[model samples]
Target: MRRLVIVNQKGGVGKTTTTANLAAALVRRGWRVLLIDMDPQAHLSIHFGFDPESNEPTIYDVLTQGTSVTEILRDTEEGLRLLPACVDLAAAEVELAGVDDRHYLLRNALSPVENEFDAILVDCAPSLGLLTLNALCAGFEVIIPLQPHFLALQGLMKLGQTVALVRARLNPMLRIAGVVVVMQDSGTLLSAEVISGLEQILAAHRRSGDAWGDARIFSTRIRRNIKLAECPSHQTSIFTYAPKSNGALDYAALADELFGTAAAAPVAPADAAPPVAAATTRDPRDAEDAAPSESSMRTATA
Candidate 1:
């Protein structure tokens, strides 16, 4: 199975959105996907209509109470499974601070069922705390969801450093697969500049024998779409909520790119239930920016 962590220390960078939708996209390609929500906010869980307050055993229990992950896995209408999270997870960092092998908690928990899915996507918290560290230890590939802003650009360097530290101290096989720019506005010059900066940064890392040495800035950039921001409120993925929207199209292309395949032959059932009404709105943000023409799109062959 391909174990990947969708992470960004910078908030509102679309990590949760990416995790939720990418898993759905992969499932449409007929790949079994397992989503692990590591964020204390439980947005990923809530996005799938699993209310965290239902007094169910969650990832927090798996990590702190010696509960099995399989016991808490829940199936979603999107054809993907999830190890949900709850608000009580916010205390896990402090609770496990003094625990031995705290960093490997998630890695160990996932080992038993590693073969059950084609991909396991971990939705990490925005902060670089113990929760994020556990995700770093558990996942082999890191897909960073970035928004086009100067501060978000700076946060990439810090996140890269965190990945480097984790690689050295915990999981040596950990690598950044690629970056997906989210909430992008292709018409903005600043967006293009941010993508240019990212290419330069990634190129530099590739030259330095870093974790992202083989990484590329993915060509399939997620476009700014209100449909994407609104899907979670409807408790479904973009593909399910607005299959004809730009958000669904972009994510489908992204899934195809990730798997080295053409557009996915739709595998969803014809009688699948229609999505619920979209009501709430997230704070709008820019999606992925442009990829420089000269930027390396191929992963450097090891």
Candidate 2:
């Protein structure tokens, strides 16, 4: 299976949104997918109408209690399955801190059933904590979902260093696949400029042969669409809640771009989203993404 961890230390950058829709999109392409909600916030679980409060067997059980994938997997109407998350997962990092091999818990948990699916997508919490480390150890590649904003830009270098540390100390196969720019505003010049800056950063990393060296900005940028945000509350993916909306078209196109072929061709972009706002030429704040201490990173990689 193609095991991928969708991660970003910054919140509200479309990690859950991308994980939900991308899994849905991949399922539409006839791939059997397993969605793992590693975030204790349970947003991805709630996005699919699964009640995390119902005391279900969650990933928290998997990591902390040794619950098998079958015991916690929730079947969805779209044919995709999920190892759902609960608010109890928030305690996982602290609970597992003293445990031996905590970083490999998730990797070992998936070993039994990983072959049963074509793809496995894990939605990580917005922190560089133990839980996120578990994901890094389990995943073969990292898919970073970024927002087209300067503040979001101010964290990629830090995340890249985290990936480098994890790759050296835990999972050598771990590398970045690419970046997906979400909530893009074609109407805003700042958004365009942010993307340009992102491209330059990725280009520089490629030259450095760092952990994210191959990470490129995906061609299918997620346009700002109100429907994308609204669908989560409705407890379904954009494909199901607003199939003909701009949100649906963009995600569909992105699915096709990421996966070789999709079962459903993207329909024409719809007008269901809010009208693009007029471009306001504002300069993005020039902030820096703090990398890990050179000594620590070098020690890890050495």
Candidate 3:
């Protein structure tokens, strides 16, 4: 099974939205998908129609109490299964603080059921804390959802550094599958400039034969669509809420681009290696800036 972590330290970049919709799109295409909500906010669970207050056996129990992920997995309308989250998860950081190998806790928790689904998408919190580190170490590929803003690119650099550190010290097989630009407003000149800047950075990385060699910038950008923002309130995916809308189409295209038939050709395990590290060293200030700001969007019911 291929594990993908939807991560971005910067909030408001559509990480949860992308994770929810991508899982939905993959399910619509006949893939068995499991979405693991690693975020303590439980936004993903709520988006999938689960009530956070229900105190159902959630990912919190699965991670801390050694509960089975299968028990927590809830089937959604579109055939997507979600490993629900609860507010109790917020205490995990403090609870698991003294535990040994905290970063590998998630990896160990998920290893048993790794083969149960075709794809496992982890919706990480907007931080490079223990939770995000666990998600990074647990997954084989990282999918960063970026917003086309001046500071978005800066956050990507910091996230890239953290990924590199994880790869170098923990998960040797981890690689960046792609950078997805989400909530993109094509009509804005700033958005256009950000896109061009991303293109140039990607191009330079491609040429450097460094940490970002295999990393790709997805061609299918997720445009800003009201339908996407509205679906979560109704506890539905874009596919079920507005299949013909731009939001649905973009995610479908993204799914196709992620795991297409041509790219399915199997190769020897020995041939797979982590992407080369980027030559760009991360500035410490970048990390501070990439951290979730106080004004970060909270998961609030409308």
Candidate 4:
């Protein structure tokens, strides 16, 4: 199975949205997709209309109690299968702190059923904690959701450092497969400048033949859309809630690119204007501090 972890250390960057819609889009194409929500806030679970408070066993049980993954799995109306999350997962980091194989618990738990699906997408919390580490250890590929803002870009280096550590100490196969730009306000010069700066950085890294050589900024950018933000509250994906909307169109294009499938529909042009370099400047220290702490990470989301 193609295991991909959707993560961004800084929150509110459309990490959960990317995970949910990408899984839904892949399932629509007849791929068996399994979504695992590692976020303690349970937003992804609630996005699918499942109450995290319900008595169902969550990924928390699988990690802490060693419960079999198949036992807690649920099928959604959107043709996607989910291994849900709950607010109780917030205690997992503390619970796992004493375990010898703490970082690999998720990887071991998923071994029995990894072959059942064609693709598995893991939705992570907004912190670089034990939970996110488990996810990085379990998956070979990562998709980072980024907002076009100076503060968001500042956390990229920290995330890159963490991924590098995981690759060296845990999963050598792990690699950043793609960088997705989301919640872009096309009218803002700040947004445009941020995107330009990111492109230049990626280009420089590629030229230097660094680890980022294989990572490309996705051609399909998720434009700011009310409908996309509304779908989660309505408990459905963009494809089902507003298939004709621009939000749906962008995600469809993203899915096509991710799956290496022929584009069934032409990608929409980016709505953004040219960037103003001055508007994109920020203090790097302030940007680094924007990442959530473990105490506050549970509430982080897109």
> lDDT scores for all predictions?
0.82, 0.79, 0.78, 0.80
Candidate 3, residue 64: lDDT: 89
Candidate number that wins on TM-score, 1 or 2? 1
Which candidate number has the best lDDT?
1
Q: Itemize residue pairs with steric clashes in candidate 3.
A: 210-276, 210-277, 211-276, 211-277, 211-278
Report how far residue 51 has shifted in candidate 1, in Å. 0.5
**What's the candidate order when arranged by decreasing TM-score?**
1, 2, 4, 3
Ten residues in sequence with the least summed lDDT for candidate 1: 293-302
User: Which candidate has the highest TM-score of all?
Assistant: 1
Whose TM-score is higher: candidate 1's or candidate 3's? 1
When sorted by lDDT, best at the front, the candidate numbers are 1, 4, 2, 3
Lowest lDDT 10-mer window, candidate 3? 273-282
Alpha-carbon deviation at 125 in model 4, angstroms: 0.3
Off by over 4 Å in 2: 263-302
Query: Regarding lDDT, does 2 or 4 come out ahead?
Result: 4
| lDDT tens readout by residue for model 2, 153-187 | 77778999999999989999999999998777655
| TM-score to native of every candidate shown | 0.86, 0.85, 0.84, 0.85
lDDT of 1 by residue, 191-264 (tens): 79989999999888886778878888988888777788899999999988887676887787777677645333
Residue 215, model 2: Cα distance from true site in angstroms: 0.9
Global lDDT of model 2 = 0.79
Off by over 4 Å in 4: 207-211, 262-302
